[model samples]
Target: MDCEILENTVLLAIVTLISVVQNIFFAFKVENESKIANSKSSQKTSSPAFDKVYTANQNCTDAYPTFLALLWCAGIFCSQGPAAFAGIMYLCVRQKYFVGYLGENTQITPGYIFGKRVVLFLFLMSMAGILNYYIGVFFGSDVKMYIKAVSNTVSPFLLIP
Candidate 1:
């Protein structure tokens, strides 16, 4: 696999790991606050902290499929470099959203908006790439040539350590 794609995949894994860790940590916090030893029973308690953590984790879980689809689609169809950068930004914003939600729900807006924009950008990239591919296939427009041209024009600016 391409290094950029691999990097993006790793970023996706990291995002999952972060969510899992946060869930576990907050679960413990809720357990401690409620003095509930049983995980299942603890979930039934009506506590603000538990609700925040549950909602935060649940929000991430709900959006995960869409994020995964967008990440892979954009990484595979579009330029991996841009996809990877977007993935990193998405991860950062998600962390912000998670932490912010734990503090105050209102604080999550910036991260939520930024994350949605990143996903939208990935969707656009995926659409452009897929369109380019189909156009090339049916019209003999030479997708590789265009890709090469674009890569040459954009490569210098994308270089990273």
Candidate 2:
């Protein structure tokens, strides 16, 4: 690979790592706040509502890891506008996340809902698009070499250090 590509990859990796760490901390805060708001003051406790809150909180664990995956994977795929694309993807997930959780009883949610299937689909496509562009940009050898570059990245990296 060209040294420029390697340099860009390193920079992308560092930014993504930092972004992921920040997201994890943010998720914890969101979970704690949700727990407090969801908590009952006068009620005697012990209910499915609490269970729902716990489950929702548990789902927040992937907040940062997902971002990290997007970052690294995006670095492998996108040529530019990574932050913008990733940000849009993140916002999309947040909207879908809340709607999915409340989807058990009905399709529509009062605020937002969470759904695994939707998240899975969105994440996959978003990452794929980013990855595709990444391969096409710095790494590709020719105008038509995008797919080849992607294949190279997906393939095993045997000791080139």
Candidate 3:
């Protein structure tokens, strides 16, 4: 193909690589946290080590989405910029909630949790709206359909945030 096309292909490859590596990181975080949470639950005192699970892990919200990002990025050769951006953006959104709301893994503070959740919801919804609008045009689909597709694609990335 042309030089511009070659450059785009390379850029897309890089983006996809980043997405997969991010997924691996998410998986490790969740797996590690699960082990720690299980072990800590059995104990009387909540140890710092136990807390480490949440604090250290990115709360592993978007693992599935990250994986999907990797897959989709691969299929499109990174041509689907909206999808890739959504995947990564969703992960970031997840981390904020995971840390702000789900941290400490205690009975969540309801007020704090609700507030954080509302914020996250608004944020993601706005992003989904944007993707739905623009990408929808390209795909010759409705906003709702595009939104659904993008949202579904990034579902795995939807961290508890």
Q: After the best TM-score superposition of candidate 1, give how far the Cα of residue 27 lies from its true spot, in angstroms.
A: 7.3
Q: Output the lDDT of residue 117, model 2.
A: 30
lDDT of 2 at 35: 66
Clashes of each: 0, 18, 5
Per residue, candidate 3 scores C-alpha lDDT tens digits across 137-158 of 7987655655556555654443
What C-alpha lDDT, on a 0 to 100 scale, does residue 48 get in candidate 2? 61
Give the candidate number with the greatest TM-score: 1
- Candidate 1 per-residue lDDT, tens place, 1-161, comes to 78865764665456556645755765665556455434447456556766776677778768877887887777667666666667667777777897899887688998898888888877876786788889888997857446535633543442221
Off by over 4 Å in 3: 1-3, 41-91, 104-161
Cα RMSD for predicted model 1: 5.9
Ranking by lDDT: 1, 3, 2
lDDT of 3: 0.50
- TM-score, every prediction: 0.69, 0.41, 0.35
lDDT of each: 0.69, 0.48, 0.50
TM-score of 3: 0.35
- Pull out the clashing pairs in model 3: 61-159, 62-157, 64-156, 65-156, 65-157
